[model samples]
Target: MIIDGHSYCFPPLGEANGFPTVQEHLRYLQREMADHHQPVWRLRDWAVGDNSLLAEPQDKTLQGLKEVNFRSGGYGRFVWTVEGEEYAKQYLPPYLTDLSHPPEMLIAQMDYIGIDRAVLHAHPIFGFLNDYLADCVQRYPNRLFALASIPEWKIEHDSQGIVNEIQRAYSKGLNGLQFSVHNRYRYSVTESWDAPACRPFWDGVTALGKPIFFTICAPCPGSTVEDYLSQLRIWQGWLTRYPNVSAVLTHGFPWRLFLSDHGLHLPDALFEPFRTSSAKLQLLFQISLGNVWDYPYTQLHPTIVQLVETLGSDRLMWGTDMPNVERFCNYRQNLETFRTHCQGVISDQDINNIIGGTAAQLFNLGDSQ
Candidate 1:
């Protein structure tokens, strides 16, 4: 079975609250936070309509920005606002005004890509998107699996709230918990899940025996590499203490770090300890188009080869990051490009693990029928 180990799906168009589009979400944040970063994300970029990549050749704004994984302007972490015309840009080739993909659309796309099943990360919305995801899973249980998202405030401020949300979603049959809390300035280290206020929530996650997934990446400005690295340590601390749980490093190619301002792609030495930690660390490689990371020298494929050799094949998985990168290349291209990269460096058996076999086992999707 060809299983896409990592991907995402948005709730259908009209199902959105205020924060559905990137621009609206940023506008909401700007209104809420009386902070320095607000202007950087709000006034100058989103409001002014000055987007470098959006103006580029792709014709699809969100998809192109996402295709490059929003490498600049704090857009990678969804910190920057992408408004009106920008929202028209799609990761898919067609110029789309509505980014919504109901279950049928997602299923059709999956069918086209030859994906038997996929583990989906729900879109982070104004309210809990779990119910929408639950409905999708219920409607197509064999074809889709999902992880639920929690608001950053709830995860940081309300411990019981976090637990409640998780329990509710789990009871509804969501597969795991997902967070992309990349903004350290707003959700400082003290307010994170590892902190006392949220410890109960982290404890509950371990207790529930569900896998955890999060995306942590360095914000472009007003934050340093140390700030980002510190959070990674905090995340690892949780993995170390709760040795029984499983978690994935889901964003920014943190598997390797963009160390130094010169754009050097080197592996973070701090993550070296967790490579063999008891808590399983599976990496979902979600680049757009090819077996490449825009980084210097080693694209993600070579890095995956290193990771597979070091961490063992079971510890890594392939994912297209779907819909988001669809504008850059066809789904078949994403799968095949990695296959091309693995041709020389990775053994065919290990390649199987990185692509689908390992993820199916980790996500417990059972045998592909």
Candidate 2:
């Protein structure tokens, strides 16, 4: 089973009438699978969250704006229009009244794409989390698991409460934690990740000994490509301090550091630091949003292939970073593109590692080694 380590199916929130019903979302996914001519069972979808679809109109609007600001800050410009709205509406539901609310599009997609399991995250705590996980697992048996997202602000005030929530989720068979580097609630890139306040949480996670999936955002204020390189250097040093911690970098380390559309043209020297340090960390690099496929770059396929060759497939995984924002292509398309490009450089066994084996091992899924 190929497990997509990171992916999403954000429920729509707000006055935007264009949201697809839960069933609609599934249906659309089925259509996508059929279009690609891939068997559904070959894929395992991890549905991480921005469950704003269940939020009130005002909250959704606020989150939408935040999303816009984040993207604009990173990409420089963005245009949202009726066409985009209409497109979104075609797939999203207006509201998610309950955790079991089945958006038609998603149902369709799941039917077509063959989502064996799903993991949910995002706001409004207990109600949705409990309901959604129960519903999905009931439907799929042991296939579905929930990944808890705790309130960042409350980590200091109620560390025990947060730990309790994680323990509770795990007791319910939820696999691990799902967090983004830019999580609105917690230590965003704007804050130094190594701050003393966050150390205890890291310690807690290490104690759990479960896999931690984190997104990496680029171009943070007061930080440049060089700064990112420095951060990685620091991270490499930090990893050695805690031997039990294992991480998977959702987007390649230097993704945000690329300055040109032609990825290869970007100074190759910048990558040397990552290449040198990455080899030493118990980290896996994933090709997701902000990765080679999303950006317009010349000879991107070759560049990606070369990177895989250098990094080794055992240290790489595939992620789609779905629904929250569509990258240049869909999940299946990206995988196919990668496979086509790396055919000569990577063997079938290596491809298996990238597609699912590596993730299965990283998360200790299925039978233990």
Candidate 3:
């Protein structure tokens, strides 16, 4: 069975999407960017090719901004206009603009791509979707496993409320929790997940016996390799504290940042967390580094081989940050990048383990299958 381990399904990015209004959402975006010390207001366009959604030549005006409007197009491109001059734009699958990504649409894409199952993820931009995710899994019990997301900003002020949501989500059939450390830095005062303020939240999730998908990253833009390593050290501490809790390092390590003039310079200390049996790492290359490389991703093959060698294939799992990746490559390429492209370097047995076996065992997906 094939599983696309990391994917997002969310409402449209407007009033009905999550925030009270489009302006409110934009304000939230601006605040988030400013907090991270990034340029405010202008959203960076990461989409490329014939379908690039960034602002064009005619959109140079930036003086009087009385009205700001975010309009979604039928062709999967959305534009943010400041009084008539388009300032920012982004791309989503046309289906997503129509009504966001429902489970049925994702399932149809999976069926077309020969994917047997998928693991659903949540994010702050998607709003409170624990209940929504639970309902999706309930509708397609055997096909999807969803992880719950709580507002990290609320963790400090409302610990019990956060714990209640975890218990509530698990009771409703959600599989685990997707906790992003970068987002915590962007939204809250505390930087570390193992901080005293975060202790209650950690204790609550640990009590549920659910896996924690830790989305670790640099504290801010232009961070160094040491900054990335420091975050991993905190994660290592968490693993030591909760030895029985299963932890998956979502997006794996930040690969592009670690590369230098010589080659990939991953310090041995980065692998220290995996010393515990409870840790697993998700392999998400094509989508994560799509802007830097093209389809088939030959540049990343060596990196993939090294991960399998260092961590052992049994501890690695394959993931496609799909829907979002549709702008980069199709779902099929994401899977084949692992299944077919890695044929010479990775043995078939190891490939099987990375593609599905590891996730199946970690999530106990075999019982449902």
Candidate 4:
């Protein structure tokens, strides 16, 4: 029942720069789980790649650049593969094992590892919604859930289209929608997401009465802590305005803001805003990066613990922005580290909520299961 909220799958090897093929990636995952002596059922990966249809700025080169920016940093490299030559060694064995590959090899890996449920997000720009999810759910009824990625940009001005997409996905038995507030098209106009243009979409989602997995990427325009703090305030304001929105702040807001630099410490101001916000919003702050547990940054654990104390476990969830940033973190280890440090600060019930229940409840997966 340990639900991993954020995870990813790469494009087929021939399609992308990261792993060579989906099968290779899955095998590596299986081997990694075995090495750690972990059960697969405890894990759930949210496959992110293969978003060809949602590609905006129609120009292929621009799209490629966007993909590289989002997925090709130092963190991205490590997630798809290990630090150095070890990644090649780790993947080569699996690559040679089998030539036949399923389109959902990523999903297969989850199954092989004993993962009871998996939630998937179809890339928004690319129209290729995950058709595989239905089959996976049919095949492993209790273990698979799909979260449709609505093309907010295309439908941003078209409220009806947005509602149509939501209804379409729901009709397919999909659980929820992965709404991106940071992509160029969605939240570009104004910092306030509760504006009139977006009200209809929000109303539709709220009417669905299902939990929507909302993500707001911190605007990392500069290298200073001030830049990170500024973005944190924007998000805090967002949560404050939409108290009914159940949102999860992924990519460790301030951490990713300063990730390019070597500094691991977060500014005190980031958590300061949330102290006064309402708790009904169900905000789930994640420690996605693995290295957060090491040195100087260990101080962040206490602050995060305090956030949980104030926000409650029902509002917290564990996530690893996999395939997007590799670094020292991934799925299994990140959760283990989070659990290790959060023991006394958070209760077992809260831990369970953070691990899976919260996400499940937020995303409305309970009834689907």
Q: In angstroms, give how far residue 20 of model 4 lies from its true place.
A: 24
For residues 189-306, write the lDDT of model 3, one tens digit per residue.
4556678888887888798898889888877546788888888888888889899998899988887787666446677888988975559999987655676678888777677778
CA deviation > 4 Å runs, candidate 3: 16-26, 29-75, 261-263
Indicate the residue-level lDDT of 324 in model 1.
58
Residues forming the 10-long window of minimal summed lDDT in candidate 4: 34-43
Model 1 lDDT-worst window of ten:
31-40
How far residue 293's Cα lies from its native spot in candidate 1, in Å, is 6.8
Q: How well does candidate 4 match the true structure in TM-score terms?
A: 0.60
Q: List residue ranges in candidate 4 displaced over 4 A.
A: 9-115, 122-139, 185-193, 220-242, 258-288, 291-300, 322-330, 340-346, 363-369
Give a tens-digit lDDT track for model 1, residues 187-302. Answer: 33435546777676677767888887766655433355676777777777777787777777664354333534333354655455456574334444434212234322235555
Q: In terms of TM-score, how similar is model 2 to the real structure? A: 0.61
Tens-digit lDDT track of model 2 for 231-338:
555555546556555665554554434535554434555345345433211112223233443433224555556655666777777554343223244445544544
Q: What local lDDT score does residue 37 receive in model 3, on the 0 to 100 scale?
A: 16
Clashes of 4: 20
Top model number, lDDT: 3
lDDT of each: 0.57, 0.44, 0.73, 0.47
